[model samples]
Every structure is written in structure tokens, then in C-alpha cells.
Target: LDPNRLPRTIDGLINALTGELDDETLLIIDDAHLIDEQPELRALIERFIMAQPPRLHLILAGWHEPDSPLIATARLRGEALLIETADLLFTSDEAAQLWQQAGKTLPVDFDELMSFSAGWPLALRIALDATNWRSALGLREQKSKPALDDYLEREVFARLPTPLQRCLQRSAGLRWITPDLCAAIDPTFNSSELIAELRRRRLFVEPFGEHGVRFQPLIAAWLSRRAAADPEWVHLHRKAAVYFQQHGDHESALYHQIAAGDPAAVTTFLPLARTLLAERRAEAVLDWMRRLALTGDETPELIEIQAAALHQLNRLEAALATYRRAERAFAASGDRLGQSRCLRGQAAIYLDTVQPAPATDLLRRALKLLPRQCGAERIELLLMQAENWAN
Candidate 1:
């Protein structure tokens, strides 16, 4: 009966076990993926399964689906049941019960915790048992969580095949990964197959929309941090930027461009800013500009766009300051049309604030900057000037 001297063949093993079992018995094989390459052991298990031994139950559990013929046959016959990650996820009630066991109540922001955990038991445990559960779920940039990192490195990432590992890490650069996006980033790998493998492994990859999937938030944050340190970080992000832009996801494109630290982010963001401002998403435009972190080299057009966005957001003082800066830059560059646009923006802001005198003065300066051929600009400036002077 010694484990070290177990019978090698199926018949020998069944014979050895026959006399020892009288009642229903259950045998569970964990890490079944490890035995996938052991043909002899696999064959023995296949034979044992086919025999359908009475009063015996078998459970094979692992991250991967085993490549077994008997299992496939049994699946078709409805004789074998599978419990996936979704089935095993902890519900809110289950999470509450865990907290009850710890002599505490669930946090008020329970939904956010759920997002961080994605119902994974290990993640829930880590968050629940942390010194500050909020801090644990923060998963902030450049922060270290030895427990989660060790588990992901040893059990999750290290266990993956090299190609799959690379695919997973590279795909983390995108907010929502699609086959086309992955193909753009890493052409050598079959993007669909790699994503399918990650899904099969239950590596926190979840269906996002019709054409996209996203890694669980915590896993994504961790993987993004790791990917940032990779040599392909810039290349991957650049590719993602191009893909998102091609797909007409301009916001995501702007995000990736800024993330890549590309000089072209400003150029890419300028047109998108106008759309965002037109849609009254002025705050979003400002946020993107903050991420861009432009120094003193802003193009007059970009400054005017930023000023307009600020004005839309009702940040009057900031808008006034930004518009003035744009006017100075345009004047320095000898762009009379650009300078006129800035003056008009400033005049509108002044008019909004009920300062007609300043508004009329700004519009008068704007009219001076436009040529006779600039018919639209002259007409717009004159109308503003006449309106402000009449007021």
C-alpha cells in the first residue's frame, strides 16, 4: 500500500485497490496539467476511466484543460462535469460570510473590492487579510505586493509557455485587447490562439465586448507595471496607438500615444481635443492635456484648443490666461489668423463674464489682425465688436 511502491499498470493498480475499498471512494488529482506529457500515466488513467469502476469517483483539477481522449468522450456522454472559474467565483454573500468569519463586516465600497478581486478567492483573501484592505485593493503604480506578485510569477506567469507569456504581457498594454490589436503588436504569434489559450487557462482574462477582452483589473494593473519595464514597452504601446487610431477609438489612441512618450502625442491629441470639446467633454480634454504634460513648446493651435476647452468647462480665469498665452505665441509666429482666433476666444470669455469694455477692446484687436481676404474672421470680429460696443 506504500505510495513509493504503487503498481505501474492499470490492471495492477485496479487489482491492488480492489481489496482495500469497501464503500464509495473519491480520488482527486490536483495539478493535472503536470501529467499531460506523461503518456504512460495518462494511458493508465484513460483505461481506469473507461472501466467506470463502481463506488469510485475521480476528480482531475488544474489550470489547463487536459488533452485527453477519454475526457473528451466522457464529456460527449455527459458523464463528466466541469467547474470553471466563473462557477467557482465567490458571490457577495460568500464574501460576506468570509468577513463574518473574520469578525468584521464587509466594507461599504464592496463593489470596488469585487472589481479588484473579480471574485477570485485568492485575491479576495489577500484583500480581506491585508492590514488595510483599501490599500491592498489600490494596487497603485510602482507599489509592491510580495504575496500576489510571488503567486503570479510562480504559479501563473512562470507556468505559461514562453510565447503565451509574451503575448499576455504585451496585450496588457491595451485597455481592451482584441485579436486584431494583439496581431498588430506581435505579428509572430497567432493572436486568436494566444488569447484562446489565456482564456482556457482562466488567467483573469474576461470577455469585454463583442470584439474585445480585458484582463481582470488587478491582474491588468500588475501586468502593465511589469510590461512597462520590458524592452518592447515603447514598441507595444506605439503599435497599440496605431491600432486604436485606425479603429476610430481616438481617445484610446491618445492614451497609448502619451503612454509611449511619443512626440507625436500632441499632434494626435489636437484633433481629438476638438471633438471632445464639441461633445462637451471638456474635462476629459483637459485631463488628457495634463497627461500630455506639455512644456513651453505648445503649438498655437494646441494652446487655442486647450483654451477653448477650458472656457467650455467654465474655468474662466484659466481660459483667459491660456487664450492670452496663445495670442502671444501666435503674434510671435507672425500668424495673424491664429492671433485673431485667440483674441476672439478671449473676447467671448470677457463677454460671458459681463465685461463689455474689455470684450470690445479684445474684438477690436482681433479685427485688426485679419486681412480683407479673411472674410469670415473679419465678419465674426465685427459682429462681436458691434455687439459689445452696443452693450
Candidate 2:
């Protein structure tokens, strides 16, 4: 066991261990990332892992994924398993069990608790302690119980570098955080480095897609509250709106546009609603309608998009009524194309319900109103007319 006689090769290590024990063994290294700071020790561990010694298991735990070639290579060879933060978050059923174990009936708004906590165990514990639990779980309220704030400040935010902290504060309202979005939020910072640092720190941010990350709901809610009174918040939202719009994420763009208190938010929404309808995301279009309170609008295009969504959802009578409303509005506005589209929508419901005669009449009127250059519209109407005749 002389320190100077340590085995440097896999075979020599096995020989050293052969007479030591006869049973399976586990070797776990917590804060294993610290070992990574020592190149010689890190290389020794890597070699040991490559050896795959008999009945020996090694587990490495740390705040960040290991920056080790052996870890990746072992993973590829199915000799190693890596568990991520997302894997450890509580499921809905697990959260329910937690409530039951606490000797409390599950709250009716348990889903809100789950959403607010984002299944983070620490956040859930904090929420479970609140007397005014509804306010604690309310995202709209954006209230962080003092205990929650204190813990997060001391444990999480305080651990971040100053620049990263500023970046998070500035981009608090953004749902999906990308390097490009971060750059748009604060041009003075090297956003890519800040984002990479965030991921490495494991500071309540999770890798989202190929190029983005998202804050856990509790973190986002807390930061949003802090950013609320900043006059620059609205300006940042405007910049976010422009960024998302340029990136073709119309739904997120619309959200930011509204948050910016932009007068053109509705204009941005109309096109996004139409696009959602066209993409057959009918439920999404309806969700946006309710979210934006667009139901009371008299705009022809808004009515048309809602009607189209209802049509896709097979709410035929509702769709027909809405289409009729849109058709009248279009006619009053002298928009022949809008009127023609509404007629086509009504005819589709009629055709669906086996009312070919009414559908044929609607299609004929639509064809007359539709412009001559509308080849696809004309073809669709002619095809519907032929279907009606066949019926």
C-alpha cells in the first residue's frame, strides 16, 4: 500500500485489488467535478473507468455534467449511465403523494402549484409551508414568499457571476432563452458565454432545444417580479418581440408584443392566429382567443380565424354562426375575398353535414365573389361543387 508504488496500468491495478476483496463494491465521488481540476488524477480515473474492472462500479455526482472523454466513451459503450436534473423533478402523481404524506388534501389548484414550482422539490417544499397557498402558487401574482426569496438569493442567485446575474435579471420575462435572445436583451455581455455558464452552474435553468435554455417556473416568476418595476423591462420586451418576430416564432412574438404595451399587439396576433389555424393548430388558436379576450372583437379577419378554428374542431354550428358573422362584416367592409372565404367555410360545414343543396348554393356564391387570380380558391370551390352534384 505504499503511495510511491501506485499502479499506473489497468492490469497492475487489477493485480493490486485481486487479493483485497472478493465482493462487488461501489465507489462514489461526490463533487467529482473538483477532481477534474487535477489533470493527473482525472486521467487516472479515466483509465480506471476504461479498465472496467470486475464487480466494481463508480458513480460521479456533481453540479455539472462531467467534462470527461471517458464518460462520453463509456456512455457510448453502454457501460455508464448519466442521470439529468429533468429526470429528478417530481411528476404530478409524485407531487400528489407528497401532499398526501403531509396529511393535507390535495389543493383543487394543485396543477398551479406544479406549474409554479416546475416540479422543483425545494420550491414545492416552500409552497407547502405557505399559509396563503393560492397566492404563493399564482403565476399572475408573481409573489415569491419571503422564505423562498431568501433561500434562492442565498443559494442560487448569489452563486452566479455578476454578469450572469444581470443577464438573468434582464431576460426574466423571456420564456425560451437563447444566446441570440440574450444578446438582444443585453448587447454589452457575451451572451453565449453567460448562457454556457448558466448551464454549467445548474442554476434552475434547463437546456431546452438545440440552441436554447429555459428557467424553471419559480425562478422565472421571482425574476419577473424583480424586473417588473424596471422601466427597461418594457423596452426589453419590445426588443424580445422584434427578435421572436424576426425568428418566425409568431406566438412568442405576440406575447412579447402584448407585454410591451404595443398598440400593434392585436395586429401581430391576427396573423399569428391565422397561421395557427392554417397549420391545423385549432386548439392553439382557440387558446390564444381566450387568452387575448379576442371573442368580443368585430374585426372580420379575427372572426374568420376563430370560425376556421371551430370548423377544424368540428364545432359545426358554432363555426357556421361565426362564419355568417364574418361574412356580414366582410361585406360591410367591401372585402370580397374575406366574404368569399367565409362562404367557403360555411359550405364546408354544410358539406360535412350532408346538406349538399345548401353547400352547392354557398359554393356558387363564393366562386362569384372570389377573384379571378385566385386559382387555388376557384379550384377548391369547383371541387366542392362537383362533390355536391355527385351527392
The per-prediction CA RMSD against the true structure, in angstroms, equals: 4.7, 7.2
What TM-score fits each model? Answer: 0.75, 0.70
Error of 1 at 349 (Å): 7.0
Q: On a 0 to 1 TM-score scale, where does candidate 2 land against the true structure?
A: 0.70
Which candidate number has the best lDDT?
A: 1
Q: What is the lDDT of candidate 1?
A: 0.80
Please, what are the lDDT tens digits per residue for candidate 2 over residues 248-285? 98898888877777878888888887778778999998
Local distance difference test scores for all models: 0.80, 0.79
CA lDDT of 322 in candidate 2? 93
- The global Cα lDDT (0 to 1) of model 2 is 0.79
Q: Score residue 341 of candidate 1 by CA lDDT.
A: 91
